[model samples]
Target: MGESSETSSAPETETFLHENQRSFDVSNDAVTHDNKKSGKPAGDSDDDLTPDDILLQLGGCGLFQILLALIIQSMKTVICWGIGGNSFFAYVPKWRCTDVDDVMNISSTVSPLTTMAINVTDTTNTTAYWNQQCQLPNGTHCSNFEFESSMHTLVSEFDLVCSQSWVTATITSVQMVGMMVGSFVVGHLADMFGRKKPFVLSMAIICLSTIICYFSVHWIMFATARFFFGIGASFFMSIYCILQGEHMLSKWRSTTISFPSWALELNLFSLVVFLLHDWEHVTLIMAFLAAIYLLTWFFIPESFRWLVARNKIKEARLVVNQMAKWNKRPVVNFERMVRSVEKSLSGDEDAKYSVIVLFRKRPLLRLTVPLMLSWLTLGVIGYGVGFGVKEFSGNFYLNLFLFALASIPFKLISIYLQVRIGRKFTSIIAYIVCLVGGLVVTLVQYIDTPYRGGLTTGFALMATAGVGAAWGPMQTMTVELYPTVARNTAFGFLSVLARLGAVIGPQFVYLEVLVPGLLYIMIALLSFISIMCIISLPETNHRMLVDRLVDDLDRERKQEKDHMDSH
Candidate 1:
């Protein structure tokens, strides 16, 4: 009878939203049941429902959200696979003058066996052996460079080598510009409208862009198509990553966050290089992947957390109940479930966040600059290694395969460490490895040893592994560090902003002609800067995923305000 009386003494309630779970502590002040007939479970102001708690009650996050994250992440990553595709296609293959003597305007029979060698009489004026005299008594250099007929590439077809080579870099940079624009466009829409619409539209746009890219008759045409491709690709990751990650339970969140990389992209790059052997065909394969995502509507729904943040109370409650049912768990009262989420008094809950806020917000300003630069530098490290792979010893395909192979173990280690050591430490070690590994790759050039090929490839692989390992932690850090209200908006804004590095990454290959060591030097510097930035970010390891407008930072400030007022 004493226990019954204790239970009866508690504040009036119908049922706990989650089975076998206690509701948040409520005030003991007697409350009138004015709305009791209306069937709403009223609660004290402290009552807050968290998604983590809701999912825990559901017994599982359910298969639907898992499949949603997997399909979207895996499919969108195909676009990421293609980012390095430019390396193989933009590579300026070895060339020899077609009419060497006639082009030099020399009067003589062209010797079929003309010997050629490099002339570096002046280090600054060094020229290729054949280029020493385009017309070797009968052959001369011309504006047109004739590459070997067996190998095919965009540089070979468009003749973007020599003086006009900047066009190749222009191609990727313009695409980055497009991505930068698209991230904002799609990100705003996703935050305002819903996740599914923008995701589906972006996939469709990707398919259209791929098809148009295949039919390009001129470089400008290809560039225009690539710009649209960038738009589609940027939108895909910016919106989709946040959409998918938000749906995940925290345990699976790490895997979902990191799932975009590993060996998946490099493997695709190797396969495209070896089998497709044609840029046009590779674009078509990307089209097919985009088409597959159109089926996502049948399976995916708005994230429950997103809905709640948006105040779609009815929908959020419905999804949670459905999730519970799907997980073979009991249902909870919608009113009680939602009331358990804490409210924010700092910022207007309905006010929209923009990209500028990333820099303006005091908590975010410090993180924004360093993390964005890291994004840029990591891109250079990743794609720079890709373009320079040919400079390494061994067969081209073999070296590319080995680089891809090296990432698997490091990526696994990264996944394990991000949870144990935390995101900051994981990113710090990865960037440090990148710095050391990049220096090793460049050091191989100065060593002048026969083992240069093995050494260069090995260290290049190290940089590649470090880049791969950093991706998951960086992604998770991005998602978890920001509040849910601004998460997707921030992602969209940052995706494009950081991708500025990704845009320039492939272009580092252009430096191969000027000074090969310069590219590695640039990479090493970027890695060091990124490591410092990682050091500055708040460690987010094992923290409860923020699912509402209530920020711990804001709460602490409020508590300090209350204490001061007591004086």
Candidate 2:
């Protein structure tokens, strides 16, 4: 049939699920997608060959690809998250004022907050030092800070201590601006050029920028470098989800989405590496790791779903066939699968996609808006807990390690609940725990009681782990919720919001110093909003992805509801 006729042959109501398969429940060791039970025929026909099934036919869930993907994700987390948190290095240790002349000084020892004033007298050759006359605001203040033991830090290296201390906040906020910019640029770039290239570029950017940050002589230079680092990290947030072999077998999708982050937080390995080296050395080491990953880029395959969606049949088949060989299976029947894919893709080639269209299209809007909120909530709650490292009662490194370690068991539990209860419930229950945990952390900080310190610490850890665990289902649900035509485009849009959350959420911890209990309250509030958003989304766990929209899903749901009403 001709192109026009082929396009006309498919029904408007029947959308082709091009990527991020959502079918196939896992049971014991067996994972099955029962199409017949869902009212489709038993055979794997061309119409039946979803992106998920094509992956299965061509060996999608092999050990090698999974391990490699996990490694990439892990390094990404360390570079983006680990490095963006430069406050640890910017730390200004104990210091005392030392530049005051002994004859005019008001006490020899002075805190940073203490201002220096010279007593005026005719014999002393008195001169007023206030009102910028002595290059001082109001009264003459300590001109130089003498830090304890000469420990190197950005704060001390360029004098961000005391009056100039706002520089640290300025750098962090600027970095967040970089992250927001990176998301918009990289999101469009990924959807246009395909997934792999932009992500690799982001990794490379992070590698260079982080090292530059380490060598920065001025606080401004450090902030500028950290800004670019933030951009790179933010870009990676969207792209890594794109790279999780979005076409993997249904059962493997959840595993790959959370693997890197899950493993990083669940172990002491990352903390061990961090403690082993100084901040500058750590920056260089992370750079080396990024560079190493860049080399491996040559080995990694581009998203085959992208290839197929763009109608690059020759390339898509080549990749799928290689994947089949890797699994020790016979090559896919290219002729059959290609015909199937081409038919499905014929009309979609001209479909227009833009970030703004999300607001115009209800199908996109319902899921898009709430999913964005959920990501924002995750950013706030996750960082709110993650960065409150001081709250835990143990060695800083051990507490950090334990915070990450705590995430594993919850994530594992989320994985089980995801397969058993569904993404919506799994996420809802997780959020509830997150909110409750934050409440406990907030309340326990006050009112004297036995084991108060330990109890508060445990709840603080739980809140962090709760946010961490919630991420797994949310990530998978998002990818599978949208269509292939606009999947990455949608991701790019959400990427902007994600970075915004990362910037806004973690900063709330600063409020704790001012308001005492306000930090945990904010964390719980965002988590509650996220849970509401999660409730708004339709579950994609057992429903298969069809083309770019939920048209088929809507139709099926209506029919099922109608069928139930007839009884």
Candidate 3:
């Protein structure tokens, strides 16, 4: 009986091994099948992504899409009304026949008010001139009258009532001021709280304020609504940039960050054309788009990387596991992954000083000064050129479209060049190009006659290329230059200074036509200064982010010693 039992157990063991081998073969085949299905060449399977793998990637793409949608909608609304355009027709009162008759009779009976009333009517009307008697003066009659042909012409041509340029400028300026203040305030709030909460809350405010602005009849109400709108916009911009940067893989971060600005430029071009007819319609469209954020509550996930950094390890593990599952990959060993992450963190700490501690220490002032000056310069020149060009040029919508298109190739080319040629060389070249372009534009403007298309297009291409080359690397450099803890604060402070430039840039454009080129020249000089500041800074091309304060200090000291020894 014992011998029979042993033989039976041996057969069972053989059956178990056969089953295990089949399962292993199936898994291997599935992996190979996925690789084949991905359409990558045979040997490239390891490098190629499967459908499941691409699905896992959609998390960042989804976030970017929502953010881009919000920016595009805001750009449409802001550019439409903020830039000079025809006054909205909704503001025009329906001219009742009774009201018109009463006003005409009164003005005709009384002489002085006749001139005033006619003058107040639509200025486009050639027949709107104040006559001795306002009652259908000779050729001109009320629309109801049989002999009222001139009345139609008058209605079509007249600008009955209009806001002055100063009023428009003041309103726009107030909105920008609100944006400048709100950026700092919102950025701090985002750091203290979390990314998603601030984004949703600000979006709510944006929807509400936009609705209010749509209904507003008076300039004060409009301006006040715009202030709150700017506040909302400020919050969204800061949070979105930070969130996008964190969500992306290191290789993709800069491109994703730059993409939002590109979306904004594209929206500006489209909005300009759309708003030429009706602004209220545009506002309504924006409000509808803003409402899409409600759906994001279901789809958008919090940044997993941020969770890990904040010590929410369990949540981070769950998120990573979910990603693996979604990609149809084997479950990652949670404890092992956590250990690896911790080890990486420790290594980062060894490489750099604590960013938080750096802020408190006085000795780090040397590093802080250069960073601040470079950031401020970038803000002035970068945003200045961005916002100021619209004011200086005619047919700004067309120019903006061309400008955005020109930047696309530049962006592609620059990304390739930066990866190959190194950041410092690319950045310095960008600054020089911008400087030369600005000077060329200035010279063109001063010439006997302006070649409207050629000069504008040429300058635009040059400037766009310069910005495309420098902007991405500049953002990357700023993040790398500061330690992790101070990164947010440093960027926030830099953004504030940049906004200062944004505020001044518009004013500079509005001040005088001749001053734009001069302003661009000054901005070019500032860009040069920014480039100079970077030369003394350490190169951080392939380095991982530094986490600890003391380590950063030691590294810097050692670097300084090395430099001294070399000299």
Candidate 4:
């Protein structure tokens, strides 16, 4: 069956590749013509305006996009398959022919069927049948009976045992709990020490916890591992966003941050596919890969921006010198840059504010409210849809792969829209689309008809676009909106809320599955709330980093006045 499905899918796969190739060809042609007109040598970095430089920009975007997708796919697999034995039953019903009898019959004729039926129950059932039937001289007998009763029981058992909507809700809640605690702890630690230290520590804990999970002897141990895993994950994700923004040039910072998320998504998809067959092996492999990230500490330098912000002028200059060398640019004078940076850091600046000061100041509350709403809504809806991808009726691997592939176009279009239409307008549109899509999904649950496929496809596409738009800009906006000293602290606070939403969103989905359409209604309402919150935000495009709460409040006032004047 697997082979047949793969064969049937070949045409669709080929068509997709052909379309991608055509797009690549057009891009290459444009780059070539631009280079010829400028009379610049290919791959030359001397002139920033050269076509080769443009290609490098595109390359950077692509590299990060691929890596982020890979990471996301890997994580999703671990989350889905790392649960107890009963979780397997939830997925079995989705198989085309799930009856133990039917599987046994199929196994009699096919030796390669072992790959698909890796479970011990499957093997035992098949062996029992073969022994009952006397060995034929020529070949094994193949059963043609459909055995409808067995199929019914298989489906019923799956629905009863593995469909714990309540458990799903509880798991999400626990994840949020971990994220909240981890964000506060890790965020403050990162700020007080440095970005690199927090990142390395988080990666280490993640690796260790994943390893421990493989040997977990009980559900309690597994759940504890999951909680710690969430903490470690939050640390890496938050700190990585900060590092990307601080390291990249302002013009390309958004794209660079956006690209890593795609890799993360892709990683989730890939891990799901592998774990569907061999969960234990895959868990070990994930742990090993995480440990390997430790090597990055050696090569990935500390953020120079953070160093300068903290008055580590010497270290900052040394890191920048390395960057300049790699780029083949002339070395910047360390002593002069240090003096300039010190003057900026120390000159008549407001005393560095603690996290409490942010809440105490009434004016800062305006920024905090919208920021919290955006993060919370984005986390619940964005992550909920991603985690729920396995619920689609089909081959798990194929469904997962398609989901990842769908993101590529969603991301490309969002990048274009973010640039041409501006972030605020594009995000508002995405939120509206998500609201409509959630409504449609709820409506489809009642309609028993052939139109279900169209509804599912629409929901998937809209959700993908909504998530792609929200995830990237939210990270960028969060970092840019706060002062340097309190940036991580503010982000940590928001992360707590966001993780809370994530916990709620999945449980909501499970509830909807139980009560029919409750989750959809909830998501739609949140989407509306998010759209309103987003519209109130000041557009940050082409704006310099504001160093104080006062500056941000004044900017908001001016933006409001400008809006009124235009009206």
Best of the candidates, TM-score: 2
For each candidate in the order shown, give its overall lDDT on alpha carbons: 0.66, 0.65, 0.51, 0.57
- As a TM-score, model 3 comes out at 0.65
Candidate 4 lDDT, tens digit per residue, 489-528?
7888888888877777777667655677666676688889
The per-candidate count of clashes, in order, stands at 17, 5, 15, 27
Superposed model 2: Cα runs more than 4 Å off: 1-10, 15-48, 80-87, 90-92, 100-140, 148-152, 260-277, 350-352, 390-394, 445-456, 549-553, 556-567
Candidate 1 deviant stretches above 4 angstroms: 1-48, 101-150, 260-262, 341-349, 548-567
Error of 1 at 313 (Å): 1.8
The digit string of per-residue lDDT tens for model 2 on 1-567 reads 112211223454444432223244322232333444455432244443555566665555785466557666666655544443453554544454454444245555764244433322221232222111222333666666555443455666676666786576567667777877887787667766778887778778888887887788777888888899888887777777767746564566777776536446335334644555345666676677777777757766777877777677788777777677676767655676566565565465556567876666555666788988888777777655655663456555566567777887888888888877777888998889889987887787676778877887788878887887888888788777776667777877776776677677556766676776576787778788888888878776654444444334444544533433343
Better of 3 and 4 by TM-score: 4
For candidate 4, what is the total of clashing residue pairs? Answer: 27
List residue ranges in candidate 4 displaced over 4 A.
Answer: 1-169, 260-268, 271-276, 334-336, 345-354, 547-567
Tell me which of candidates 1 and 2 scores higher on TM-score.
2
Expressed as tens digits, the lDDT of each residue in 1-567 for candidate 1 is: 011211221111112112112211111211213323454433322344456555555643466666666677677555765565666666666665445534454434544343222111232132342352224343333465656544577777787765566887788777777888888787677777767777777888888887887788888998998899888877777776677667665555677777635377767678767876666667778888888877776767777777866777888877776777666766755566555432322234466767776766555665677778877776678766766676677676677778778888888888788777778899989888889988987787777788987887788888888988887888888887776777777777767656677666656666666766677777789999888887877766544455433212333233333433342
